[model samples]
Target chain A: MLDIRQTVEKPRMREKISEFRVGDTVKVSLKIKEIIKEERNKKKGSKEKVTEKEKIYPFQGIVIKRKGGGIRETFTVRKESHGIGVERIFPLHSPIISEIHVLKKGNVKRAKLYYLRDGKKR
Target chain B: MIGLIGKKVGMTQIFSEEGKVIPVTVIKAGPCKVVQKKTKAKDGYDAIQLGFGEVKESRASKPCIGHFKKIGLKPMEILEEIRIEDLSKFKECDEIKVDIFSNSKFVNVQGITKGKGFMGVMKRWGFKGMPASHGTHRKHRHPGSIGQHTDPGRVFKGKKMGGKTGNEKITVKKLSVAGIDLEKNILLVKGSVPGSRGSALFIFSDLNVPVNLQTTQLQAENKPVSVEK
Candidate 1:
């Protein structure tokens, strides 16, 4: 039988993920491939009133919980945009994650910050 | 027709190039040596006998030593014969590594399942036992009935009553070969194989790979796919 440690080392994942715990605010950079938009829409002859603008959506959130082990381990990040809680879970060893930046350390005393969903707790 | 002697090495998770976690059973497969070949004319079938694992000379008895000496090979702890279509392709003492399974997409793992002694119908056969509430007495886990009253006048032949369970040879068919570690002689199967760690398993390369799945030569195409545990 193989030792658990040995099997986990197969095709080793990146060992240096930014270490942040539950309740810590962090920013995660994710690479996304989006299609290009037409730039010629503003040709004065165009009577269409373009009231909405395209804004870049990348890099956000606060680490709420880190669960599981080995390469499957993941952490949940929560961010509030316009008062709505938005949470994202990212695998610690995922190659798709470009970078993890620990913005601030939280002093809360809990393993999982699920209580944050209640919105009133510190 | 291809086979190998592998030790059940337990299980672990591995990440593929695409960064997905796959649960896999790791087995210490051979570095096996072909000991003998059975041909149609001589044995009514063609087969290859493979020897795996090693034991100290003193631990091997005279008869066992004689068997190895007769074939001019070292003593092996496990010896198993696998039916093959051709016997002329191999010679005695030809080293077979984890690589034999490397070319194979799926394998049939034969091992004695873990024994669960004298179990009841509920645990053995998935019988939903009677309720444990106020109305129930000692018949909670008891099997409801064995047979009808007077129809056949005899108990049915293949009734699903519980008796001794497990510790019997089981064949887990169509298990994909997830990975092969030639240096460690280990094989990572995509799913759980019967038996526990340190148990002996006879891993035979499937001869009957469906025509569609065989087009890829059984090698993994996508990275880090989830395997059933």
Candidate 2:
């Protein structure tokens, strides 16, 4: 409802995006490619009905911050993967994203949750 | 590749479909009218002059108004020429909008960079002046030496001495065409282009490169766009 015209020239491109807020837990479905070895090993006569297939890797992270506007907009999602803080920055209007699922919302005072790096948010 | 005369509307951030943050410059381009056409036989070249922006009839001089009337278009403030092999396709009074480069991948943006007042060699030319060490005096920002004094006795022509910097036409080549809004007549080109906001800019697609608007589309389909600004 904000002047969509001012930001993106194509609002239709933005139609697929889901609205979520900061401090929200979200799951991002990322398309990933993995080689199929077993299918390659089987002989041509066997007919396993498979060769290689693209897989979706779900990355669940908390919305630490959402920044920018229009087509240049991006958000940083932080999630502890393997005990290491992994923050993925995704452009909100990009075509690479498959889906964004908002899980839960958090109540915080600051706009940026950078303090989470220090484990203060926990 | 077609080019459009546009005014820099300023810069803003937008989210890609991958939810990545990209810095983009907003440009209000075109809706330009073809002012004149340069033909191979007449001018020994092929090009079309485009007029951009609107001018009030009251502020327009008689000659300028007559010129617009000859072309059957309202008065425009900026006029620029774009070359093409076939000039017959475009005639006077033909309207060109941002849609021409809608699906384009890369564009060459040209503008005059902001001018800085007279500056020293260090900031102006990136000359590493005298070091910040012991026994260094007023020679910090000074030009150590123009040249060997005995041989030439005069500094060579076009030496890298500092004087005025910027305020020159600069062309930013192959800037990605991030997005285009046909309704608003806005064009978003990826990365930083020269000149300040509200300054005039020219957008020309690189004919040699294949436009990959789908790279953005493919990425957008993968990530859901989300932004906070």
Candidate 3:
């Protein structure tokens, strides 16, 4: 049943998806859109000027878990800032992800490094 | 409105023009053939009959096979008649493709919701069951009360109660069409439709008044409308 579904989704799936797995330290660049509205008092008929800007922000962390399959695939990353652990799940084939750079691959036995959720897990 | 018979091919996500992710359900839509055309002067109504999918000769009745053979067409597995106001351009054996909706921004999909047989009031009707701790025994999932004992005693005819859930025709209106594949006859409708994967659905163009399912019920009450693929 999923075979026909795969055919429709295969083309949309990223061809250059980064080859990385759980416990791998990676930096993910995300695309964010910002809308700025400017008002000008030139004329009564003039409308407000609206501008859209695309920004790329980077989130560097260790891959804690990866789940789902096909275009719906997603992975969770854990990073600590100010002694507080932060985790974000990214859809593996999401267009919002501008780039993914694998920094270091850790030799972890488990597929999901959820133990890191406890904070500073050895 | 004109529509095509389509089979649910499951769902997936695709990037929009602005690089935003959009969830869409892929449907293998027609390539349906106009098997017969009904004229008001002849049949008392103006309509067009369409045939979809193909099957072996042995699977179909001999008379059905002859009917298709008479028109120089292969025996189709499913046949549907749609009441149309404009039938001047269409003719018998004319092919209708998914491209009929190339300019359609949205479509209406109708299908049977996944059936969950005979369920309790709590699951089916969202009725708040009895409290667990307040001296309640075995009526935890029971519906609180029926009505007055003698005055208008019997339960209302259309009262919400525990019974069959789903497995009935439902139309989801105004689902945006995310994409269309003319070559593959695939329609990417933004959002989910009723029924499971491989289930048959009627995709009606937004311009049409969604007469497919309702007309089927009004015309043929005993027969199953769309064939399950």
Candidate 4:
């Protein structure tokens, strides 16, 4: 299994990624593309020119679960947005992820913190 | 159609330009050497015999070594014949690489699936077994109600009973080419291909018939003709 994984994922693996474990509060800077529509005057009629603008959206949350291995590894981050809990799963090696900054490391016993979803306000 | 012999490396996910994750199977294809070319006049069809994977001369059989020696190449472990409409583009001893599929969008991968041995009706034939409850004793995974009562007599011959599961030639059609690495001679195809890692696979451009000859013909037609006096 290790031999197969090395051959398949080694070529596409991300070179530099900050090492952060589960139960760590991290800020993930994600690159999002927004399509901006503008009216352009052409030869006969007006046409809409849709252009894409790239922006970085920072999401700060606590890492609840880290699953998979190698290039297919993914981590789930849970955060409270406007008193509502929001969970987002992001591939660790995805090119869309601009940067990952570890804010705080919480010492936890279990690998998956799925109990936090049902427990009372932490 | 032109094709190359490859080995199934493994499966991994890669992000597309749209940032969507696509599951892909990595295939270590070619550097295949054309060992023989069959023409319509000689063999009743046009095809190219390609050889891949180097093997030690001592380890290979005498006939296999002689076949490679005739083409002026090292001993190859696997050999496959690909039927194409035109065989003039390829020549004996010419090396075919992964770049042959650079212009191709989709391909059909043929390989032997993993063997599951003798499986039950529920697993092999996808038969809905008997209910676990309602006093159903030890016949839970049995193939309930095979045929009719006295009219047909015995069970029908062509029944979908479980026997052999896999380990047969399976062709997966129209798998999109996710990416290609020329330097490493690797091809990343979208979705899972047949067989496990290191299994030999025949990767072709089309499933039914070879159409790569059309591209060569179009290139010939587009060539600038010299003006003569």
| Candidate with best lDDT | 4
> Per-residue lDDT of B25-56 in model 4, one digit per residue for the tens?
88989989899998889998678899999799
lDDT of 1 by residue, B1-229 (tens): 5778988888776766555667888888888899888887998766788999998989999999998998787789999997655567689998888877777788889999999999999998999888898888898998887888788878899888889999999999989877877787878898898887888999887654333333333333644444343
TM-score winner: 3
Tens digit of per-residue lDDT, candidate 4, span A62-105? 99999998888999999988878899999888889989999998
Checking candidate 4 for backbone clashes, the offending pairs are B1-B210
Full candidate order by lDDT, most accurate first: 4, 3, 2, 1
| TM-score of model number 1 | 0.79
Top-down DockQ ranking: 3, 4, 1, 2
TM-score of 4: 0.84
What is the docking quality class of candidate 4? acceptable
* lDDT by residue (tens digit), candidate 2, B28-147: 887788898888789976789989988999999999999889867888898888766556778778889888886677889999999997989999788899978789987888778888
CA lDDT, every prediction?
0.78, 0.78, 0.86, 0.87
Q: State the TM-score of candidate 4 restricted to chain B.
A: 0.86
Tell me the tens digit of each residue's lDDT in model 3 across B110-191.
9889999999999988899999887999999999897768878788888888898889999999999998889888899999
Best by DockQ: 3
lDDT of 4 at B77: 83
The DockQ value obtained for model 3 is 0.67
Instruction: For each candidate, give the interface RMSD after superposing the true interface residues on Cα.
Output: 2.9, 5.6, 1.7, 2.6
Off by over 4 Å in 4: A1-11, A37-49, B133-137, B149-157, B207-229
